[model samples]
Target: MIRRNVLLLGLGAVLATTFPALALDRALTPEETQLIQQIGAHNSAIRTMAGRFLQVDSQGGRTEGTFFLERPNKVRFRYNPPSREEIISVGRGFYVINRKDQTQYAYPQDRIPLRNFLGDKIDLLTANIVDVTSSDAYMAVTISDDTPIGVVQVGLIFDKQTLDLAQWTLTEPSGAELTFSLYDIQKDVQIPKSYFYIDPTYKAVQPK
Candidate 1:
């Protein structure tokens, strides 16, 4: 299951680096700033999201998958293409099911690196700005947490004109990165609550 998260992280890291920034001279106008604030605010309040994921690693490996995310802390990753596995988080607990082995692993969410990565109270823009720059096409902001073991840095790229989030990256402490690009991002989309529940039959494995 950690492999699954690592794969997703790799994808997000690559996508986050691909989107180049716009020209530096083009400062963000008041209107553009307002738009960015609104977008950030809206995203902060988003309760759930479903999207396609494409993750690439520094080693030239790639994985594609689908993800379901519920804010304030619930997420599920269904990886396809190279392998089959499911990772689901229910509140403070998480579960990983290995389809090939017909096994499951359970652990407290706080014990995993992903818990800090998927924090609900965080807003990519307002949370903290590590650095900000712009190019002819977009503006980029790098953000990171101050933790030791849980440290992760994210780069947010936004369209220069539209100020919409074009892409973002999640970089793990081990130097692994995952990039996530948003397409047709729908805010406040109704996601069924049942998606977060773990099946009762699967035996839970104690974390090592």
Candidate 2:
């Protein structure tokens, strides 16, 4: 499962790298708007997702992991292969346990990027869409947001056939990128309430 997550993440990074040129002059066509609307509609009601993710850093290092996500705020990531680690987020805070170090780190939800993964209010179409383009294979939407950390670019890739989200990329202000791919997606799945609670045994640490 961890391998699956890493793979998904890698896929996302690949797609993000494929974004159209920043200086392109094409505007969002009617067809593109319709497709975007369709994609948004299909995902609007989705409340939970569980899958494997593979993440590759800019340096080409790779890690595989399994992840669980519940909308409006909750997620868990378990990395595997050589090292085992678990990071989970309740609605208001996040906790990470490093098995090797026997250390735990906890922080407010807003302090981490995980906050963005747990909400539906984030609308890509209405955001700062910098560019839009389409090909026979997929529709690409590029957007950016200004945050205290800096401007972050988000690229959304949608399958041309299904109009579903194939992947997304987040380009940090520092030029680092994190991507996510969705596969074996289960929508509206029932997740237990307890899944959002932090374990009491884990020590809590304040965010810097």
Candidate 3:
């Protein structure tokens, strides 16, 4: 099994009251509201996408990978050499597979923060949006939700001018954070269904 510290995908959690949904620290500005809506609509328009990603955890460990996404709940992340890990979600389930050991970990799609953004439609305005912040370069919307483990937060950051998703961050209840960024994205492209397939014979394991 993959080590928890290595992937830090301890995403299953229940809301622990540390991050309240819709209980914003402050109100959103008129412009901020408009931009948030536009961002939501822009992402909702993407039916399929392929891209390269860079993932960095709080400890500074970095991993580069290629990812494919099909709307309404399907995605595959294949890490580059030396890392035999792939995270695939086909409809209702998320699977983390270790190629080296043929070991797998499973999770329900709804229990993950990715569910909020991967659906056929994205509505930040109606989601458990806890905070919205912006800078000259990017606009960020932070969303919180309950999981079996504890409260988990995911932040989506979009390019300020283009309204395109640039990166996202996930924070575990234990305060470990992982930042994932996208590049060379090709939107509306066709990807094979086999890419999201889970090996039926892979050994199943629980999250560490």
Judged by TM-score, which candidate is best? Answer: 3
lDDT of each: 0.59, 0.60, 0.76
lDDT of 2 at 85: 63
List candidate 2 stretches off by more than 4 Å.
Answer: 1-11, 14-27, 93-117, 204-208
Ranking by TM-score: 3, 2, 1
lDDT of 1 by residue, 1-208 (tens): 2344443321122234432332223455675566556656655666677777665555656666777877877888778745756877877666777667666776566544445336676454444444465578776665554333355566667776664556666666777666666564555567788777676776766434
Predict model 3's lDDT versus the native: 0.76
Top-lDDT candidate index: 3
The RMSD of every model to the true structure, in order and in angstroms, is 5.8, 5.0, 4.2
Pairing residues by index, what is the TM-score of model 2? 0.70
Using all chains and alpha carbons, the TM-scores for the candidates as numbered come to: 0.64, 0.70, 0.87
Worst 10 residues of 3 by lDDT: 8-17
lDDT of 2 by residue, 104-204 (tens): 66655554443433566545555556677677898877765554355556667778787666776667656766666666766667777765555566665
Candidate 1, residue 100: CA error in Å?
Answer: 3.4
Higher-TM-score candidate of 2 and 3: 3
Candidate 3 wrong stretches, greater than 4 Å: 1-22
**Residue 8, candidate 3: C-alpha displacement in angstroms:** 8.1
Clashing residue pairs in all predictions, respectively, total 19, 10, 6
**Candidate 1 runs further than 4 Å off:** 5-36, 102-122, 125-128, 146-150, 160-164, 184-188, 205-208
lDDT string, candidate 3, 103-156, tens digits: 998777677767777888987888777877777988877887766567768777
